[model samples]
Target: MNTATIDTSPIRILRRPEVEKRIGLGRSTIYLHMQQGTFPKPIRLGSGGAAAVGWLEHEIDAWLHEQVSKSRVSSTRA
Candidate 1:
């Protein structure tokens, strides 16, 4: 019998467009946040490619949680 193993990594890389769609932000907005160091840094997918890609899904999820918490806190204060 033969068996195969599957690899599972916490990081889920996404293309620029897909990431923008997922975050509901436009291309410029995405770049703006990146410039502010508030967004995940993209990883180079190739040595000489013009396209940019990135991962750290866990980080994004954490960011979402933080936003939710902030919203709740503000509502409670108001």
Candidate 2:
């Protein structure tokens, strides 16, 4: 008998364009949020001095959910 295993981990690297499209935010906004410590920091791809970077898909999803939750809480308080 043979068994197949499924990778259940949510690990996925998303580049800048995809991340911006998914989150509906532009490059500057993303970086601004990062500087404010409110967004996920991207991982540097390849060697040093390269401008390539990527963010984990799961982290972005989590950030999206957090934004929704914050809005809901604020609305309820009003």
Q: Cα lDDT of all candidates, in order?
A: 0.74, 0.95
- The window of 10 residues in a row where model 2 has the poorest summed lDDT is 1-10
Per-residue lDDT over 16-69 for candidate 2, one digit per residue giving the tens place of the 0 to 100 score: 999999999999999999999999999988887976999999899999999999
Q: Where does candidate 2 clash, by residue pair?
A: none
Which portions of model 1 show Cα errors greater than 4 Å?
A: 1-10, 49-51
**lDDT tens digits by residue: candidate 1, 40-70:** 7778877666755675666666766876898
- For candidate 1, list the clashing residue pairs, or say none: none
Candidate 1 global TM-score: 0.67
Clashes of each: 0, 0
Winner by TM-score? 2
Give the TM-score of each candidate. Answer: 0.67, 0.84
